[model samples]
Target: MNETIGNIKSRRSIRAFKQEQIKDEELQLILEAGLYAPSAHNQQSWHFTVIQNKEILDDLNESSKEAGKIFNDKYIQQLSNNEKFHTFYHAPTAVIISGKKDSLMPFADCAAATQNMLVAAQSIGIGSCWIGLVSLVFNGEKAKKYQDKLGIPEGYQPYHAVALGYKKVKSTKAFARKENTVNYIR
Candidate 1:
């Protein structure tokens, strides 16, 4: 298989990460890949907020878990109650992906960008995890405060996040695929 295909097949969600920060240049390459992701109507309405500060990450984690405590989903509530669970898995760097509120297909656009970043990180031997749980905090009572503090555009809504750092343990094997999930029209 080609390198791209190999990378795609091998990429896994890394839950454990080293405390060391990834190089700024590597982070840039990952973000650049996100910037290159396709968007609907060429509307690249995504914004990335990179946070390396431990204090902020801790605060966000705590807030997200607190918000998750009352979530309608039982799984989320359980995660919230589990003191061992961290939304970002304690990665040294966390990026919040936001989308413009008025843009068409903002969620999809941001999602594409997020995937691009993930693939790019994998290709470059970096560890990454897509962090959807962080949204609980952004959607909660302190949303406005975080939006302002994170410098998210006034008209944008935070959608997803990715936690990035050096890997504590590298993952080379892909999980087994579910059979018959794809169909070809041809």
Candidate 2:
């Protein structure tokens, strides 16, 4: 396989991370990679909140748990068993992806940016995973308060979040892709 293809194939959802913090310069590059992702009409409405403070992380995780209980009882039950699930495998840092709520493609634009960050992190030997559960937090009062604490302005909404740090393990196996999911017109 070609180098780019190989890199894409190797990227995996890294759930476990080392306790060490990522360097600022490397994190900046990862964010820059996300900023370069394509947007609808070139609006670039996405906003990224890079969080590293332990106290704030814990608070967000707790608030998320409370919100999950209100929105998804099943998820709350699962989290009851694994507390770390509250913050995406306890990764040291998280990038909360938010976008203008009025935008027609807010989620899509934020998702593309998040994917770019994930691939860039992988290329640089940093582990990253898309944390959809965090996005669910936007539906409740407590979560809304947390969002405000994160400085996600009144007109913007959280769509996705990604956990980033160094990986605890590596895997070579590829996930089986679903067949017949795509069609090409030529």
Candidate 3:
């Protein structure tokens, strides 16, 4: 099998992360991968906010969860009740992916870039998870503080985030892929 395909097959969402931070080189590569992701008309309207400081990380975990409280999601409500829950799953580093306002297909561009970063992280033995809960917090007035804290560019809105760090426990199994979801016209 091709190396890239093998990597794609082996990658899984790692929820538990070690305390150690990812190496600078690995972080650079991951960010580069996101930058290289194809964009609509090559507008490249995405911004990457890397948070490695423990204090800010903790703030993000708390604020995002607090922002999550207004949603009707049971899981989110449960997370609010559990003091142990960290939105980033205790990852030592987080990269927030935001899209520029007025950009064509900003969400799509961000999604592709985010997937690229996830694959790149996996290729380098780092664990990663795409987080949507945090985006919820960033969607309304609750976002102002984080916007300033993360230094999100004035015209950009954070669409998603990825938590990155070494895995506390490597996933030993891959779930079976769902079947009958594809169609062929030829």
lDDT tens digits by residue: candidate 1, 1-186: 999998788889999999989999999999999999999999999999999999999999999999999989999999899999988999999989999989999999999999999999999999999998888777888999999988998998899999999999878588778999999998
Angstrom error at residue 160, model 2 = 0.5
For model 2, how does the per-residue alpha-carbon lDDT over 58-157 read when each residue is reduced to its tens digit? 7777766666656647756577456556566778899999999888798899999999999899889999999877776787656667777888878888
RMSD of each: 1.1, 1.9, 1.2
lDDT of 3 at 1: 93
65, model 2: CA deviation in Å? 2.1
For residue 168, what is the lDDT in candidate 2? 90
Q: Which candidate number maximizes lDDT?
A: 1
Model 2 scores what on Cα lDDT? 0.84
C-alpha local distance difference test of each model: 0.93, 0.84, 0.90
Flag the better candidate by TM-score, 2 or 3: 3
Candidate 3 at 37: error in angstroms? 0.6
TM-score of each: 0.96, 0.91, 0.95
